[model samples]
Target chain A: MRIAVDLLGGDDAPAVVVDGALRAVRADPDLNLLLVGPSEAADAVIAALDPVDRARITVRPVRDAVRMSDHPSAAREASTVRDAVAAVRDGTADAMVSAGSTGATVTAAALGLGRWPTIRNPALVATLPAVGGPVVLLDVGGSLEPRAGILARHAVLGAAYAAVAHAIDAPRVGLLSVGTEAGKGDRARRTADPVLAAEPLPCNARYVGLVEGYDVSSGARADVVVTDGFTGNVLLKAVEGAYAMAGGPPAGGGVPRAAALLGVSGTVVVCHGAAVAADVASGIALAAHLWRHRATDQMAALLAGHAWKGHDHIIDTEVTTP
Target chain B: MRIAVDLLGGDDAPAVVVDGALRAVRADPDLNLLLVGPSEAADAVIAALDPVDRARITVRPVRDAVRMSDHPSAAREASTVRDAVAAVRDGTADAMVSAGSTGATVTAAALGLGRWPTIRNPALVATLPAVGGPVVLLDVGGSLEPRAGILARHAVLGAAYAAVAHAIDAPRVGLLSVGTEAGKGDRARRTADPVLAAEPLPCNARYVGLVEGYDVSSGARADVVVTDGFTGNVLLKAVEGAYAMAGGPPAGGGVPRAAALLGVSGTVVVCHGAAVAADVASGIALAAHLWRHRATDQMAALLAGHAWKGHDHIIDTEVTTP
Candidate 1:
């Protein structure tokens, strides 16, 4: 599968992105990278590859790029992430991977590749290896507000992603809150709890009452954890900080530095802003894996078959303008 | 100062609480405990101590303890926590400590001691040891909804607590968000960011723009980290879980399991519901430390002298009922 790489996305920019592209091509023989940046950066990857493997790489070679400090509105301009999104939209690449500003990437993806049917906001889904299995967490930073409709939609998206991407059967979905007891949490959670319970989920997923922060890493209580982008983003980073404080991560692995952008028509993966070469490589691999499994298409199909008839009004009313 | 101890407060109450009380009395020669629970539980602590040291222990036997599963409103009944709060209200005890339901303790304290001037919701402030110094996090579970005015109040409360309790000079206060950039969070955070920046802080504290989850564990950015109780509660637990996932905590220390209730008229500390003997002992120590320092009274005096006159109307309208 061909994956578009945003060479100007990360803090280190061309250097780390080039190194990551080389690694991604080597890791998978069939992997092809459409390097979307300056010619000098694309040449760095091409010069590193063997003669026979060089053909697996392609260069879009766009000069103008978005800087980390640029406003998110820069994504609308001609930039590396926008070019990468265009590659996927035009079917030149199977998926796209970027380590740029999350706001820019989300804006580019949602605008370039139209959002799926009932989703006004795209949710960023991250999978962490838990004690029992992989736990799917959604809306890590895509939609900050946790309205009942947004949370209900995230439940369905997370469940479908878990089933299609991770092959989990009958995934147990949970709303992340302060306590497991009923009627716990802030105003948004109190309003969202009942809505999630009634919302129809794909893959035979059932809504578990409520789960706490530990459930995100332990995976003992739920397979798919749904939360507002704000809480999920903060929780993910806090877990990373704690691991750093404890010296390193546990045996399973470190906290994921990449997340999949769900609800967009195309496959998009966002790497952490401070990601290094290895993190970018892993993000590209994740994109290729999703593309190989056709996770987005399959999940979308599952969602299409089980649409929430009365929930459209809820989404329109509850989802605030960003 | 004599402190009231709720013997039936934790998951393994009476046993853990008795052991904790015994340890507290032994650790502080001047410490005295007014144990509020069944006579049998108080006797265990007295029996464990020497006859001479036993005089430091007093019992206020009240059998009906608030169970962890009971509704927070149950604090209105004649439960152990209610009796403990009454002991403080009637001037029989200088302070109170409980490891029971946080909601119950907060409710009882707010109702019995009365809230500070211009404060509607009390905040749970927790101090965590960081590389530079101690990082103070507020609203751990007190006020979940993040109103701009409430957040502004918490910023003041956290800054004053850090100065009065920890003696941090010119503490740097930060509003917690997904990123350090301005306008990078949910609606509440976006709205509160400007308010916190403009709000006057006590103890010569200065407002830092914004901080991420890592700042909570690492004091490199800010000394006082402020957020809604929902994010703070989940982030604290998630950090604890990450530390557990790793071998253990860093050399400095683990995440704090005890938090002090701010904005109330009396000195109170709330321990985790599943606190152990050592945790309970440490919580008692925290309460005594606060009482000895006269932290609450000093903070109240500071607020009274520099009240946010125009902000009271904002709090009334913005503070949503749970």
Candidate 2:
């Protein structure tokens, strides 16, 4: 499988991304990389590999990259992220990975590949290994201000992704909130609780009423946790910080630096902007794994079985707390 | 100083509360407690102490308690939490501590003690030990849907509390958001960001723009982090879960079980509902520390210097994201 790697996507771009690409290419014998950045960065990867095996690597040679501080609209212009999405659209790459700005990547993928039916807000799903199993957390930074209906839609996406990607039977889904009680969150959570309860989930997943932050790491209450991108992004980073404070991660694993972007009609992985070489390598590996699993197509097929009109109904009942 | 203890509070009440009282009384020679619950629970505290030292303990003997599942309005009735608050109001206790439902505790404290001047929404502040110093987080669960104005008010309270309670000189305050960029979070954060940056902070604290979730634990960006109650509450618990997942807490400490309820007339500490014996003792100790430092009164005095009228302007600019 060929995965497009954005060479100038991270804070320490080119250097870390090049090192990560070398590690990813060396780890997987069948993996081929389409380096999507400056030629010098691509040469760094090619020079590190054996002469005979260098044929597995190719270069797109894009110059500019979207900065972390740039607006999402900046992705509309020429950039490595936009080019990577185009490669996926043209079927030159099975999947793409970027350790750049999450907003830019989401915008580029949604614009180039197009979103799935009825998914106005795409979700970035991350799986953290828990004591019980893998816990799926969505909208890590995809749609920062999703309404209740959008959150309900994400519940469906997360359930389907958990089943297809992780092969978990009857994944238990829970809405992330301040408390586990039925009505214990802000306006969005209070409105989404009942909507999610009524919405039919695919893959035999059942909606657990509500879950607290602890459930994200323990995975005892639910295998899948749905939240707004704002909260999920913060929670994911706080967990990462806590792991760092505690010396290192547990025996299971550390926080997943790579997250899958759902709703867009392609396999895409977005890494943390402050990603190290290992994090970038993991993002590349995650992209390859998702592409091999055909997880996106399977989730779309499962989602097609249901009639999703929650977006239309969201306008009437959305909460305005002012 | 005398502190009132809600013996019927928490999931594991009476048992842990009685044990906690014993530990607290043994630790502090001048500390006195007014146990509010069934007579038997109070008797357990007295029975464990020597006859001469038993004089430090008193009993209110209120049987009813607001359950964790009960509504916050339930605290308005004749519950143990209300009685404990009444003891503080009547000069029998200097402060109060409860490990019951946070909603019930906030409600009981707000109603019984009354809110401070110009502070319509009370904030629950928690102090976390970070590598740099003690990072103070506010609005943990008091106001779930605070407007930008309320968040600005919380920034002031968090700053003062950090100075008086934790002795952090000229603390740096930051508004919590998805990203550190100016316009990176939900509507509330975007609205609150500029308001906080412009609002004058008490105790010489300065606003440091927006900070991500990792700052809450790292203390690398800001000494005091401000957010709406929903995000702060969930983020606190998630950090605790991360610590638990990483074998144990750092050498500094774990997520604080006790949080101080600001914007009220009296000093109060609310422990987590799932608090253990050690957690209860820590809550009692925190209450005693705040009372000794006169944190509530000092904060109120400092706040009097500012003309906090942000609440009046919130209605006009609050985002209605449908």
Candidate 3:
């Protein structure tokens, strides 16, 4: 299977991306890679690789990348991310990965691959290392304010992804809130509690009502925790900050530097803007794992059974219209 | 000044509360206490005090206390928290402190003391330990929304509180968001970003665009960080959780176990539900400090200057009606 890597992505791009590519290619003999960026950057990786394994590498040359100087919207015209997405659609690659501007990549993927039937918002899922196990947190930076219907949709998506991607069956789903009370949290949360309660879940997943912030670190309350992207992003970084404050992360792992973008038609992984070589390698590995599992297709099928009828109206009135 | 203390106010109530009162009374020579709760619990404090200090203690018998089980609405009823608030309102006590339910304290305070003019939602503010200095975070559990107007008002309240209570001059105020970019963050943040920027801040506080979770811990950015109650509450708990996970806390201090409830007509500090002896003592100290500094009155006066003309109306119309 072939995967496209957006070489001109991340804070320390090309160099880290090249280093990660060499590591990913060396680790998986069956993995075929398409480096989608500048030839000079691709040459850096090829020069370092074993000559005999060079046949597995493909280069799709693209100029100009999303730079720190460029506007986030400039990513639309950057060409690298869009080319990466195109490779997936054209079947030249099974999946793609970019550690670039999240908004840019998201916009590119949505425009190129087209969203699923009911998913108006694609969710970015990160696996946080916790005491009990890895806590799968969704919408890390996708939709900012999720409506009741969208939250219910995310719950279904997160559950199926946990089962198909993480091999966790019957994943417990939870709504993140200030308290675990029946009626706690902001207006949207209070409104969505009843919706999440009644919605049907995939993979035998059950909604565990409200869960607190500590639960994200403990992994005791739920396997799949759902929240709007805004809160989820800050919470993710806060946990990372906590680990930093603690000298280092716990034994299991640290806050994931890479997150899998679920709900898209193909497998995609995103790294932190400040990603290092190790972070890039992890993102590549995560993308490969998702591709091997055929997790996206499986998750999609599971979600198809749980259709949300009231979602469109909710989005139009509650979210989009404003 | 006589301060009524609820001996049965926290998870380690009575024992810790009694121990805490002893510490406060001994530490602050000018302090006089009116221990209100079960007489046996109040007796614990009297028993620990020396003969000279014993004369300073008074007991008010309360058969029932507000349990963690008691709903927030119960605070408006005839409970210890209500009684504590009433003592101050009726001129029997100068101020009050509780380590009981926050919702209950908020309810009791709003009902008994009445809100500051035009202040519909009173906020909970906590001072976190930061490397650069103390970072004053607000709305730890006040209102949870992105109303541009309320956030702007919180900016003023936070600034005034910093100047009066924390003694920070020309405090730098920041709006919490996912990114530091001008247009970064979800809808509320995006809208409120400009609002806060345009707000005529009090006490020479300046708006410092957007800040992330790191600023809250490091205090390298704005002195006063403002966000919706939902994010602030969860973020505060998460920080406390982080401090615990990191093995105790930083040398400077731990996450403040007690928070000062702002936007009310009087000085009030609410401790954690699981507050220990030292935590209660600190809460009492915070209340005394604020009272001594005339912080509450000054903050009220500050709000009076920048008061959102119809904040309560907005709360009633935008939140409760839905």
Q: Each prediction's DockQ?
A: 0.64, 0.59, 0.43
Tens digits of per-residue lDDT for model 3, B1-322: 8787877788888789999999999999998888889889888888888888998899888877788777788786677888888887887777899999888888888888888876777888899878778999987877777677778777878998889888999999999888787777888888888778877788888999898877887788889999988888778876666656556577778788889988677778899888888999998888888888888888887877774533443455232110
Between candidates 1 and 3, the DockQ winner? 1
TM-score of 2: 0.97
Off by over 4 Å in 2: A309-311, A314-322, B313-322
Candidate 2: residue A201 Cα off by (Å)? 0.5
Q: What tier of docking accuracy does candidate 2 attain?
A: medium
DockQ of 2: 0.59
Comparing to the true complex, what docking class would candidate 3 get? acceptable
TM-score of chain A of each: 0.96, 0.96, 0.95
Q: Which sections of candidate 1 miss by over 4 Å?
A: A317-322, B317-322
User: Tens-digit lDDT track for model 2 on B1-322?
Assistant: 8999999999999899999889999999989999999999999899999998999999998999999889888999999999999999999999999999888888888889997877766788999988788999987887777578888888899999999999999999999887787888888788888888778888889999999888987899999999888888889999999998888899999999999988889998999988898899999999999999999899889877776757575334332110
How accurate locally, in lDDT, is each candidate?
Answer: 0.88, 0.88, 0.81
lDDT of 3 by residue, A238-269 (tens): 77766665566777778888888876788888
Q: Candidate 1, residues A1-322: lDDT per residue as tens digits?
A: 8999999998889788888888888888989999999999999999999999989889998998777777777899999999999999999999999999988898899889988888887889999877778899988998888888888989999999999999999999999998898888998899889989988889999999799888887888999999989999988888887787778788988888989999889999999988888889999999999999999899878877876833764457433222
**In candidate 3, which residue pairs get closer than 3 Å at backbone N, Cα or C atoms, i.e. clash?**
none
Residue A149, model 3: Cα distance from true site in angstroms: 0.6
